[model samples]
Target: MYKAHFGLREQPFGITPDTSFFFACPSYQEALNTLLIAVRNGEGFIKITGEVGVGKTLLCRKFMTTLGDEFVTAYIPNPFLEPRALMFALADELEVSLEKDVDQHQLLKSINHRLLVLARAGKRVVLCLDEAQAMPLDTLEALRLLTNLETEKRKLLQIVMFGQPELNHKLQQEAIRQLNQRITFHYHLGPLNKDDMEFYVSHRLSIAGYTGGRLFGSSAIQAMYASSGGVPRLVNILSHKALMLAYGEGKHEITARHVRAAARDTGAARNKIWFLGWLAAAALITVGTSIGWAYFK
Candidate 1:
């Protein structure tokens, strides 16, 4: 809504995992590089773990987008399925034809055939599973089995799992130890640090065609860092709200007050001191007024 007012072609703080708006902060860059290097090395299973709203999905989308033509990429955004259903999802992504009511064995055979064909054609097939912690145990084991289909040199189907930190706990399960062991390159994506957050917000704004002075002031940036804990998604949310409030109030610059108000409205930052101080001062003012009235009477 404020895009025109902000002089931008699009909303800068959108929550969508748009690869175009991706900010290459240090941690995310490292994670992407780690995935690229590991996959190039024919690593059977590469895993990225991060907390919710830490931009794992965004990083995954960017990686797949930039992965280029040498690889055939299949993305499974939601992996909460039975072994048979999981196979169907992968098949659908790979464009492997499936007849109606095909049994599990037949489906697996078709997938294996497709993987082999891609391998022969000098194409690397990568299966990227997002939200992988929700994947069924049997399905994860099935994925491990798929990795077994390999030439003498490298594995046929490379797997990259992007998931919440729960995925690590899932990996620790004894049942999926083989899959866990196969994860040679692992990157845990954490929130951006304070300095990174400053750049991240500005970088996103610049990408969205923001031209002019810095929209977010330094104190406002500090408040953003404090409130968002440097999480990109949270920063986007808080910053977007602050922008709307600023625009509504006829302000061009985003101040710390604007950020705090946004935080209060958003149930983020949760600065009890602000509220508590307001309450305490109100109590004192009320008492003083009452005493003055009594003396006047």
Candidate 2:
């Protein structure tokens, strides 16, 4: 809604995991670099963990998109499947046709054959799983079996798991320790710092076609850093609502007041959580009344 007033080409703060809007702050760059290195070395399994809204999904998409021609990537956005379902998902991703009555043993054999064919063609296959913390315990064990398909020198499949902090606890279980031990590269994707948060906002605005200088005031940036604690997704949520407040006021720049009002209306800062969900009903009413009064007056 504020794009026209701000001369932006699109919404700068959408929550979708769009790789095109990726802002390579230090943590994101480091995580991406680590994943790339791990894949290149043919690591059997790699893990990237972060708190919610820290941009793991976006990083995963960007990593897959940027892979070189020698790589073939399969993305599994959902990880709550059973071991059999997991195998079927992989087989589907690899374009391995399956008969209606094919059992688990036959299915796995089909997948192994596909991996070998791709390896012979000089292409490395990488499987990426998002929300891996929810994967069934048995299914995780199944993944270790899949990784065992290898040539003499390297693994046939490289796996990368993107999950929240709970994935670490899940990996610690006795049944899954083998899979955990196979993780040769691991990185914790943390939130942004103040400087990176500010830079992130500017970078996204510029990408959205905003040529207007300094759309967010220094005080506004300070408020955002405090309210969002340098999380990219929270920053986007707050900045977006604050911009709407400013737009309603016919103002061109954001201020601390706008940030506070936006925080009160957002479930993120209001509930002491990171960016998530919509504002509570009462908070919504209050902010709506306040914004209406200010705008109309």
Candidate 3:
């Protein structure tokens, strides 16, 4: 709604995982580098975990885009399915044609054949599964078995799992201990810190065609950091809302009041500000009561 008013060609604070607006903060950059190195080493399994709305999905997409032509990628956005169904999803991603009512044996055979073909063609196959924590135990085991297809040199397929921190706990389960052990490289994505938060907002705004000076005031950025805890998703939600509020009042630059108002309008961002406000109020009340008692005494 405020795109034109803000001189932005597009909305800057969109929640969608657009690589163009990606901010290469230290944490995200390191995570991406870890993935590149692991995949290049022909690691069988790699894992990346982060909190909710910490930009895991965006990182996954950015990683795929950076691969060279020698890499063949299959992406499973949702892996919450049975073993056979998950296999079918992989087969579909790899363009492996299958007949109706294919049995488990034939399905596995088809996937193995596809992997072998890709290997022979001088291409490496990488399967990226997003939200992998929700994957069924049997499905995860099936994933481990799929990596067994290899030549004398290296494995025919590589797997990259991106999920929330619960995926780490899930991997620790005895049922999946073997898979966990196979994870040769792992990286945990963290939210941006205070310094990174400032650059992150500017980065997105610039990417969205904001050619002017700082759109978010210093106090506004502080309020955003306070409400978002430096989480990218929450920052985006608050920034977008703050922009709308500013535009509503025909204001050009966003202020702390705009950010706080936006945070109050958002469910996730609202909690942090409310707790901080409550703490501040309680502190003031305690100081006032103590001073009053001292004077009376």
Candidate 4:
């Protein structure tokens, strides 16, 4: 809605995991680097964890796009299936044809054969799973067994898991201890810091074709940082809302007042702004009382 007023080619703050809007903040870049290195080394299992809205899915998509022709990539966006069902999903992702009413044994066999064929063709198979925290315990073990089909030189299949922090806790369980131990390369993605957050906003705006001078005021950025706690998703939500508010007022520059109003409307940011506001009011009252007491003395 505000794109025309802001001169944006597209919506800058959309929540979709669009790789084009992927801001290469420090944590995201480091996590992607770790994934690339681990996969290139033929690591069996790699884990990337982050808080909700920390851009794990975006990073996963970007990683897949970064792979060369020598790499075969399979993406499974949902991992909450049973062992047999999960195998079926993997087979589908690998484009392995399956007969009607095929048993688990045949499913595994078909998958193994496809992997070997790809390996012989000098292609490294990489499987990426998003929202992996919901994967069943038995299904996780089945995934580990799939990795056992490696040749002498390297693993036949590499698996990358992107999930929230709960996935780490789930991996700690005894039921999936082996799978947990198999994760050779692990990276935790965190939210952007203040400087990175500012750059992130600018980067996204620039990618969306904004050539204006500082659309967001410094105080507005500070308000967003405090409200969003440097989280990119939250920042996007706040920024989008603030832009709307600014557009509604026919203003070019987004100010802290716009951000505060946006934060008030956002459920995740509303509490934080209210708390900060309370603190500010309390401090004002304390200062007023101290001055009155000093004057009376």
lDDT for model 2, please. Answer: 0.92
Q: Can you write out model 2's per-residue Cα lDDT over 1-297, one digit (the tens) per residue?
A: 889999999999988888889998878998999999999988889999999999999999999998999999998999899999899899999999889999878998899999999999999999999999999899999999999899997889999999999999999999889898999899999999999999999999988899988999999999999999988889989999999999999999999999989988988766774323344666788999999999999
Model 4: lowest-lDDT 10 consecutive positions: 267-276
Q: Per-residue lDDT for 132-165 in model 1, tens only?
A: 9898888999889989988888888999999998
What is the lDDT ranking, best to worst? 3, 4, 2, 1
Q: What is the C-alpha lDDT of each candidate?
A: 0.90, 0.92, 0.93, 0.92
Clash count, one per candidate: 0, 0, 0, 0
- Cα deviation of 287, candidate 2, in Å: 34
lDDT, model 4, position 270: 62
* Candidates 3 and 4 compared by TM-score, better number: 3
Give the root-mean-square deviation of each candidate in angstroms: 7.3, 9.0, 4.5, 5.6
Candidate with maximal TM-score = 3
Can you write out model 3's per-residue Cα lDDT over 1-297, one digit (the tens) per residue?
A: 888898889998889899998788888899999999999999999999999999999999999999999999999999999998999999999999998999999998998998989898999999999999999899999999999999999999999999999899888999988999999999988889999999999999999999998788899989989889999999999998899899999999999999999988999855666887999999999999999999999
> Which 10 successive residues of model 1 have the least lDDT summed?
266-275
Arrange candidates by TM-score, descending. Answer: 3, 4, 2, 1
Report the lDDT tens digits of candidate 4 across residue range 66-172: 99999999999999999898889889988999999999789899999999999999999999999999998888899899999999899999999999999999899
